[model samples]
Target chain A: MSFSLKKDKQGVVVVGVDGQLIVGNRQELKQKVLDTLESGGRKFVIDFTKTGYIDSSGLGVLVSLSKKIREQGGDLRLCGLNEDLQTLFELTKLDTLFAIARTPEEALAAF
Target chain B: MTQPQPPQPPQPLHVRRRATGGDTELSLDVPSDLDYVGRAVELIADQLPGGPLSPRRIRFNFRTAFAEALANAIAYGNHRDPGRVVHVRVEVAHDAVRVHVTDEGNGFDPKGVPDPTLPERLEREDGRGLFVLKSLMDQVAFNEKGNSVCLTLRAG
Candidate 1:
């Protein structure tokens, strides 16, 4: 559906991924993140508060962006991960990799 | 003589068709079904007759695999077929439990899926479904001729 990207002066991009993240919108998500990166925004706080569910494809896009951002000497962070996604991350062990914060404020300040 | 056989009642196409003929065959239907997936693992675990630790272990493996498959089939499958039902069948053979979850959507290309465990892609959610299924199940396969997928979990 409609994904919105909001940026503050801090250069920490706050992305709101709404609705479901399935196979179809996965590429859009990747492009959106890359576009944000190209625009000189590196440290990111992806808000998953509205994201009820995300499949494997969506997860892949996030990882792809994470790698892209990492190469630029910046890091991508995740915030508001739901219990289900958290469970998945815990199960997959990727939870250990990302800097997760409870809120956007916490994430932006983490770096 | 052969013409007299035509007097018999008509049979539905699905009924007239043969079973996949591997093992057990099950049929299920989903309605407004919110939670959607239920008892999928218990069904598979029941395939194991008995042992001290068999049920629990089988339950764990089958539950993980079953939840992932059903979640995809329900979450992704429903988007493609709104208000459509998902039918599941399981064949319990001596070697493994073969499960088929059929949906109303067009078939998918499984080979196009990417690997999840590659160091670079580890953070993604997209590659996890099949990877999790493959990791949990002995073998997983798709048959779209009838919009069905057959996944197998080994039995001890």
Candidate 2:
């Protein structure tokens, strides 16, 4: 997975990930989250509109990142997940663990 | 103990094709590489009959199950060793699609896989692959050795 980060007018960081998020690129994704956290961007939104695939490994990274961010008194929201990803999150019951918004704007506004 | 045989040279990844009547069957011997999982998913998607499934169902079910099975084979079965091979066989019938994925690694007990649906297991990063496969596919079964997985999807 490759990501581009931009902060919104509210200073909430919006991370747009392109391509598949699988075991092959999960480390890079984790590092991106860590780096963003280190740079003091607390509120976050992960945009998954263009991300076509995700596996257990990818979900793992997201879960871990959510936990870490929460522990640090920050919040993360997910937005733009296509149908398949939404079903995946539901199947694994991860939907309960995340705050999902329909659009990036909603996610940004959530913070 | 039997003397350990010299490590055989790694098997080259290749696909074997067979055509019978109007049906097409393919078998792929891929090196235990995670990168090939996406390629495999794409190949399967390309071969699926177009009339029975919507594009969204195709992506949600077939690709998801296939990717999970391949990931398990490489990560748990082959331990991510490139020298190992994961054999995948796909048969596209008129009414159903069947895929068999076998790995070279020592098998584990499929029955013992954790229940990801339980609230306690929800936050864990791992253990969801099999659950997803079982949830989406019409049928998912493991061989006696637990090293091979068979997934089937029936046409609606």
Segments in model 2 whose C-alpha atoms lie over 4 Å from true places: B1-14, B47-52
On lDDT, the leading prediction is 2
Which lDDT tens digits does candidate 1 get at residues A8-103?
787778888885554546677788888878888878888888865555556667777888899997789998876666766666667777778887
What lDDT score goes with residue B70 in model 2? 90
Candidate 2 chain B minimal-lDDT segment of 10 residues: B8-17
Per-residue alpha-carbon lDDT of candidate 2 for residues A1-111, written as tens digits (9 for 90 to 100): 278888878878888888777777788888988898988978889899988778788888999999999988999999999988898888888899999999998887777
Fnat of candidate 1: 0.32
Cα RMSD for candidates in order: 12.4, 5.3
DockQ of 1: 0.15
- In model 1, where do residues sit more than 4 Å from their true spots? B1-127, B132-147, B150-156
Could you report the DockQ of all the candidates, in the order they appear? 0.15, 0.59
Interface RMSD after interface superposition, each candidate: 6.5, 1.5
